[model samples]
Target: MESTPKHQQLLHLLLLTTLIYLSSAISIQSSFPQEALPTKSGYLTINSTSGSSIFYTFYEAQNPRTPIYDTPIVIWLQGGPGCSSMLGNFYELGPFRVSFSLRHNVEHLTLVRNSGSWNRIFGVLFIDNPIGTGFSIAGSPDEVPRNQHDVAKHLFIAVREFIGLEKSFENRPIYATGESYAGKYVPAFGYYTLKKNARLAKSRRLNLAGVGIGNGLTDPEIQVGTHALNAYYSGLINGKQKMELEKLQEEAIRLTRNGNWSEATSARLRVLGTLSNMTGLATLYDFRRLKPYEDDLVGKFLSSVEIKRALKAKESISFEVCSDLVGNALNDDVMKSVRYMVEFLVKNTKVLLYQGQCDLRDGVVSAEVWMKKMKWEGIGKFLEAERNVWSVNDELAGYVQKWENLTHVVVMNAGHLVPTDQAVNSQAMIEDWVLEKGLFATGQVTQKPSHIGTCSIG
Candidate 1:
């Protein structure tokens, strides 16, 4: 019953939601039909004061008539704190959702036709964060901060540099979005940006709009508590251990009261392991990848000979290439990012939390509990909407909860990654919420429905 960040919990249903879009987009991008995406791929570096350089890849929307500055820019972050945004770019949302197909152009597709990609209206920037995941490398492992504030400071410096180099992006409304471990990363970064803005009001360089997180790892206390509780409810653990877990939770709470998180987490982890039935590695019983992927679909659409021909002809993107990485570094980075996010939340910044329904690591039960704890308040009132699909146990499982300038939501039929799990549905909800500010202004779901399909308890 270890709970994930509220954002991560709600995205468990995304696989089902995005299946249709993925099928169609794959067909078109593979040359089964003509497909187009809005993006001009490039890379940039942000040099940190600690002498570490953070690398990021930009995907600018490419429309013959539209200028780059005209498109809203979204900086995408993949969770794991150590995971690569490239995972989101290729496997999840970006312009072209990449599959493990050894195929050519078919491997990726445009965000618009994909129905789940943020590309149609957004200029996407995929960052390999914390200077370890993907291509980003740190000068020293020790340079990475254990506390969240330093992490935010370094990341802010990187983002600020990117903005300085790309002046056009300055004018465009900028938003940050991510999933998994990002629950903390997004909030921390957003807070840092707001702090920087306050300091540089005279310069007026930053044009940040908001922050978004999907299937995030939010507060460790609540999330971990949910993780243990859910496991018991889900029948992953039993009898004496369950009672022991409850007692441990009580102890943890008491420790937190006494400002002893180390003891609290230590006790919590021991109980969590029994509750989750961990097999050495930390993972939830539900929402783990249920099946392996089938064969690569690349050859079915495009021939290797054709790809070779295109390459010989000197084409821009004749072949598809997956991201390359070494080893162990990614895992290390994820751990570091997690610590940083926890520190970031104390700042005054806007945060948007989202997730799919099918995700177990981060799930709806946890989200409900999380909202209650956040002491949230909306800047504007919530709007009632038609055809809301968020529900569980005969209660509207979703809510448009807010705090200051932040908005947190749970999407239907999504999993660990909402954009990838339920691309179209998730995208529709996020786009409206973020770009149009619909969560604050229009088409917002106010009351939870009594049921979704048949999963309601009542």
Candidate 2:
């Protein structure tokens, strides 16, 4: 049959469009490598109502005594309210640590196997929590959480989805763990999990076994109050200077008491900034170091084309170590106390609170003050418990105190990031605490479920 010139032109245009589409697809496919990741990684929609999702990377235990499915899972949430959990993953306890090298004046990044990864005997799940941080995507600006309540809620949903996705994860003991700002998060999540579990059927409950916090800022009122004393005692300030800092601390406390939360957060920052100005030290995180701990390497590595492709991260969203947007949004919630949550968690679950000896912010003194203030039935017993010397391979690692379900440890020669400062020791601490070894062998820890069962999604 004879065809018109218009029909012939339409056919040619269709063919050209199909070829271009195929070419674009091929180009996109070629950009990413064909290799598989060593661990399971992906995003789970946590809030369908708000269109939010969370990104996670799961590493199975490398040397578990039992089957992989039966091994305990540690869900690590890095604090900053805005900081990415990837920092905890790469800089601290992930199976691989990011290392850098210079050649011909150009720096190269590489991942090296870490001997002290926390996943040695227990599965580790690193989550970039709360939307709009790390690779986690928020549907809109409104989707970003403004309070610990929303943060815990999002995390709860994400974990429920994760467990539902994998049949074997149902029965595994889960520990909510994190450091720094996550001090609030860990307890909030634990408390929320317990609250939710109370109403849910037995088969649908989250198997939350315990909670662990390291150098965390759980109670800002008590924690912030310790700054002046800690600084003065550490020789960063004199008596007169201490008095001045105390004035600033008092103002922060007043604002916190008045419920001017944002103002309190600002006041807290001012207190820290003033201390930094007076000390002229490298970083309050670790005063011994002459320079600040740099995380530019981590930002560089995670944002690279190759790493993003490997982790299934969206290329459109840039990776940041911390998000100021998130920080600003939660300013009002910062100075508020989560002490009640901690008190509740300590009663219901195994609570391990640890501190780095040298950390001025949210460190030993601050934790001690709050612990003394806790109205828990075991507080007296905890304070009276004998402080036992903890060692790793015959070397002094730290001092530990245990009473009932609570354990507190003062890690020697460590600072804000204990895992990063004392890798081997921190790893050993987690392994022992989770497995109920050494000082944690008091036999009062929560028992793991003996039978494995699938969780039904409500």
Candidate 3:
């Protein structure tokens, strides 16, 4: 049978359309650092309705083992409910640290090699998550997430798009990691991925392997209750001050229980502020420091024209360390707990929760309080597991406890930002956990169960 001229023309058009779609899908920009490890930066459209997108920077491992595809990929999210993950990239664990200098009263910013970069063994992806935060763009104010569910959905979409676009990332084991408010973000994202994967074909599933959180606020109710005791025991507050803080804590809890979310968030802030005023502490994040850690230089550098071009960031969007708009939009979510997500993740994924000993905000005491209240089946074995001393280069670094798929570490002499305060130790800790070396390898109480039950908190 002879085909008509119109049929031939339609076939040609279909082929052309397919080619254009394929090219665009894989057309990621790789125009970043030539001297640094392989790096790529781009934006993934997350919400078509709002024209919202998430900006991300990915650095391939500097020294991956044989069969590089086996090397894990870690996606890092910074907490502010509004903070940029670039802070995690530049200040904590990226290929390079941003060094600031003043020459002749002029400020200069330069990148210096960090000996403790997490990317030394694992590919690291830093994301400016939640529309309106950092370089991530939201077409309208309405796009900013108001709760963890939306935050998780956006993150999941961004990651899925990224992996589908970048062929190298396909089939690679991925881990969700972050700190601070990311504690909630990390678990929420992990749980969302697992739930989504359950319904997808094996080849289409995201290979989400584990989750790691450092000094995170996963449970505000329990964590907020610890501030007073933490202050009083640390000698920062006396009995009278402790009681006052306790009263404020109770109010916050009551508001949260009554579902006065925004009011509860305000109450929580007041409690923190009162504790700060009474104790004369420079910052609640790290009690050892007389002044708060600053990231002003980071913002300045990221917002620079040269960096915008290098990172392929939009020149119109100036970088911010923390987005107030994003924070305000999530005010009501501040006191909400994502502990259930963490509980679900521990049952099906390897979970690493670490706290810096010196961190008063989400430190060991606060974490321990929440852990005791956790209803996981493995809680009994985890509590009985010995906390072995973790050391780096023959020096005591922290303590590690492992049971089933759950691992906890207490980093000594560190603050809220473990990677920044104790870079070397934190790097070692992540490496060991991901690679199953050292304490993580030797500290298992029982082989991870094939099936685990769900848990809830009151």
Candidate 4:
């Protein structure tokens, strides 16, 4: 207490040094993430409600635009409520393939070039969501959503977080694109984003531009009705088999009318089974494949020691192409219709509905039937619009029709996976619509310009 002037001077010096040190530390902390630019395969962890950790990867544009801010981002979701978006990555539109022979083994696998990557024009994001799907982990069973709304909310959080972390995405136009079950997820997420952006106008929640669903299972009641007709017209079912399919469809319709989603789903599956069980050579997802995806290929590649290390993935993580546990948990949600969400999207932005010509699972006709009936803006114009052939490099790629901002396309010679079957053509279609509309040349008029029904362009 009775210190000399010298002691006071030393104390003052020490106080000054500490403050300088603290300031320097704060500056360093602020600049900490200047670590080398993140790689294309970067992870995004979304802390979702009910305590779930959603995992996602952004494969920056395959051919990213310079000054990257000008480029666009498209989030790609896989169909299964539990399926890994990695399926879209390796098998459909991502830049890399698990292996040349994805049919079986990943024993000597490599990441080969995918000519059909959507990243050619936009930065692509793949998410493993719904708590326990793919490589995503849930803190508990409570984290998993029991309904479509909850799942979309989690993804909404994820998208906001992604924009915050990835500065490059802040100003770019974004799209929500998915196939199969994604018909529901894409629209739900799009509607959620639209509402969120409206509330937070000062915030740029993905600069959402549009949504595209490819051969998706969106409206089950309307879509399931097309199965019997799809079977008969595709020459899979005879007149008698067609009649039997009609019975299954009628049963499904009755169940749906009575609010029995589970049974309705079962009935729809039976309608699909009419063709599957009879053919002994059913390629519901594809006309070329006899069996389902080779799940082992993705499992082995993703779970491998070297690959995981490269992506900086967690240790002791298991990978599933589609998680039955997650699927089973959301079984009821999947069978319900998301037409309202689609209606909201239709009124707001460009809505692209693409169907693969060969898909028996949620084919083109199902989408066409419901879309015409939906009470969205311009439905009547869409109903009466004439079809035109869109040629890619002077070859027939698909048939396209436009009504206001809504676009409906039926890709020729493709199955459930349009990009996988018709990568170049698919790219041309997406690029034209999303970035430069009315860019591709028109070819010989599509078959029955009166109907724009179906014709091979390739």
What is the C-alpha local distance difference test score of each model?
Answer: 0.55, 0.86, 0.86, 0.75
TM for every model, in the order presented, reads 0.66, 0.88, 0.89, 0.84
**Predicted candidate 4 versus true structure: per-residue lDDT over 1-458, tens digit per residue:** 86679989999999999998765542100110122122445445555443466677676765765568988888898887788887787777876665633222222555667787787867888887776887777777666777788888888887777778766678878888999888988998899888888878566555888999999988888888787777777777788888887888889888988888778877877877776876554478765566765645666667675565565556567878888888877777756889988988888887889998877788888888888778775787777766877677877777888777688888988888888789888887888778645632222222343233446433
lDDT of 4: 0.75
**Model 3 vs. true fold: TM:** 0.89
lDDT of 1: 0.55
lDDT of 2 by residue, 1-458 (tens): 97679988999999999997765542111122232243788898976877689999888888898886789999999899889999999888888777876654456677777878899889899999878888998888877889999999999999999889789999999998999999999999999999999999988899999999999999998888999999888777999989999999999999999999999999999999999999998888887878777776688788777788788788777899998878887888899899999999988999999998878778899899998999799888778777777777877778888888899988888889898888999999998888888678864433333333332111
Q: For model 2, what is the C-alpha lDDT against the true structure?
A: 0.86
Of models 1 and 3, which has the larger lDDT? 3
Better of 1 and 3 by TM-score: 3
* Backbone-clash count (model 3): 0
User: What clash pairs does model 3 have?
Assistant: none
State the lDDT of candidate 1 residue by residue for 1-458, as single tens digits.
97688766557557656875666553334332224322333233444455456656566654422576766777887665465565676566765553444343345422234556776566777776766454555566765454456656767777777777666767776787877666766777777777678778645656777777777766655665666566567555676666777777777556655656556646655655655554232344234444422212332222344432321211222222222231232322322224233224323444566766656666666655554554323322322133344433333435455434445676654556666656666656566665545334433445444555544221
Root-mean-square deviation per candidate: 13.5, 13.3, 17.7, 17.8
CA shift of 98, model 4, Å: 2.2
What is candidate 2's CA lDDT for residue 227?
92
Which candidate should be chosen as best, given lDDT against the real structure?
3
What number of clashing residue pairs does each candidate have, in the order they appear? Answer: 45, 0, 0, 1
